[model samples]
Target: MQPLIDEARTFPARAAAHGVNLGPHTTSATPQAMFIACSDAHVVPALITGSRPGDLYELRTYGGRISPYTEHEPTSEAQTIEHAVDVLCVTDIIVCGHSRCGVIDALHPDSEAAPFHLAAGHWHTLMQFDALSAYPCVQARLSDRTLRLHAWFYDIDAGTTARYDPRASTFLPL
Candidate 1:
């Protein structure tokens, strides 16, 4: 915690030297995508995608799970998606799952350290995309061809990424 605090103390100075003009960005931020990933510290969307500040609107959840939309149930996940879609007008939505995910293993103990666990991770990514489709904001944007939903898999060991190809019903090299 002290290290983090020390870094925060110098952030103002270092950020200024980073050469990004933050003045204009102070008013409104228009990010390129809505990145939905697990809360796991290893699954860093920004570092994985080489995105800087204001490049991605991130929503992190346990296992990156998004609840199925139900009008009666108001969830922060849904609200985040609505804001990212309606207000930010982000064109892309990425659901990323990582290798050897503890959440995935905990949820499915039978598949622990097995091939099924790996498959489950990929399945989970696509499931999030399906969940997002249930959101009216996402559906509206998708219907108008203004939004695209993507499912990604990140191998922690190899540091390689794969994207789901709905046509092939499989993950392919990104």
Candidate 2:
């Protein structure tokens, strides 16, 4: 409560002095690209990608993991992707993954066999299976000439960004 109050008081002053608009009234008209990023507090999609409010149409996931492309499930990520592509018509779609992700850590082979929550356990299990064999499973759904799907690994500790290029079979620094 104290921290929130402090920030509320200080942010406006800082923004005003810096000539930055801190108000929430401005509306974003249109977005150029669709950014898919993790919901980790450490992972700020706009800050990481240097995007402004209206520049990117962002979709955040637990670990930025997308399940197999399926439109059957009502709340499936497929709907989000389809909307971003077909509806929003975003020219680029970036799927960003970070190192030491909690979701990934949870899905690690050594993690507990049975999670406390069944739904969470099932989701992590699905991610583990997809991440282990990321080659074809991830590639099959994301491989498209018109819409580019980028798999990026952001290393928080090292402050490095690696893009996976399946053709070259390497993680090149960006």
Candidate 3:
């Protein structure tokens, strides 16, 4: 905590030296991309994309899950998506899942592990596949061609990345 505090204390000066001016973005944020990623400490979207502060509107969830958007019961994930699309008018939405994901393992058919002790509401939102189809915002945007959606898989151990190909129905190395 002390080390982190020390770093925070000196960050302003270092940021200024690097020409990272926050004045323009202080009033409003206008990120072109909405990055939906897992809540894994190892996955850093800014680092992965080499993006500065206002480049991405990030929405992180446990296992990168995209919960269904119900009119009566909208999840925070849905709200984030709506804000990014409707308000920010983001052009691209990237759903990034990584290898050895805990959520994927939990949902695996072959796994005989005990039920996860997640909240009851969260447990109900968990599904095996078709995450993009389940998301209302994603479907609407894609159909209208107003936004492009990308599904990416990061191989944590292999240090490689793959993109889902709909025609091939498989992930191809990027």
Winning model by lDDT: 1
TM-score of each: 0.91, 0.65, 0.79
lDDT of 1 by residue, 30-149 (tens): 899999999988888988999878999999998889988878876999889989999989999999999888878886787345878878899888888888888998999999999999
Among residues 3 or more apart in sequence or in different chains, the pairs in candidate 3 whose N, CA or C atoms overlap within 3 Å are none
Global lDDT for candidate 3? 0.72
Q: Write the per-residue lDDT of candidate 3 for residues 52-108, one digit (tens) a residue.
A: 889999999898887766878887878888899878888897787776667656665
lDDT of 2 by residue, 46-130 (tens): 7778775467887787877666644355345666666666666666666667766777566564546434333343344335335
Mark the regions of model 1 whose C-alpha exceeds 4 Å error after superposition: 24-28, 110-113
Off by over 4 Å in 2: 5-29, 109-145
Local distance difference test values of all predictions, in order? 0.88, 0.62, 0.72
What residue pairs clash in candidate 1, if any at all? none
